[model samples]
Target: MRTFTVEIEKDEKFYIAQCVEHSNCFTQGKTIEEAIHNIKEVIDLILHIKRPKLHIILKDSLVNAL
Candidate 1:
């Protein structure tokens, strides 16, 4: 698992959440909790779609064989 930093701030009507590691990733919600949840979902989606190039090994077996 990887960890990323998230910064949240309140605008005029919504709470905005942005990933410090990924400037292009951000989301907004009516409440701080909602904003955090939305940002988490967004990060998951972004990471899932743009997976890192690193490889994983388990019991000398390579996952994501490619």
Candidate 2:
């Protein structure tokens, strides 16, 4: 598992959560708990998308080597 830094701040009416490593990764919620939950969901989604590509790359490399 990989670790990332999350930064949380309040803006007007919502708490915004952002990943320090990924500028484009961010989410907002009414409370800190909600914001954290939402950010986890977002990170899961990102990893879901990236995981498949990584698997594909590894598969291709192994196939090429064989």
Candidate 3:
């Protein structure tokens, strides 16, 4: 599993979570725990799927290229 940095910011009533490596990846929740959980799930979904920008290799479809 790859490691990612999660930054949390409080905005009045919600906690916003953002990935340091990905500017477009962000989410918000009512609490710190909820924000963390939301961000975790978001990261998983982002990493597991193909991205148009980076063309990231799908985690579930990786293959040996040797």
Clashing pairs in 2: none
User: lDDT for each of the candidates?
Assistant: 0.65, 0.64, 0.63
lDDT minimum window of 10 residues, candidate 3: 54-63
Supply the global lDDT for candidate 3: 0.63
Which candidate tops TM-score? 1
Tens digits of per-residue lDDT for model 1, 38-57: 87778778876332221211
- Estimate, for each residue in 1-66, the C-alpha lDDT of model 2 and write its tens digit: 566677777767887877777778789889767977777778778755332111111123323545
Q: What clash pairs does model 3 have?
A: none
Give the runs in model 1 whose Cα sits over 4 Å from its true position: 49-66
Clashes of each: 0, 0, 0
Which should have the higher TM-score, number 1 or number 3? 1
Tens-digit lDDT string for candidate 3 (1-66): 356676776767887878778877778889767877777777768766332222222122112311
TM-score to native of every candidate shown:
0.70, 0.68, 0.67
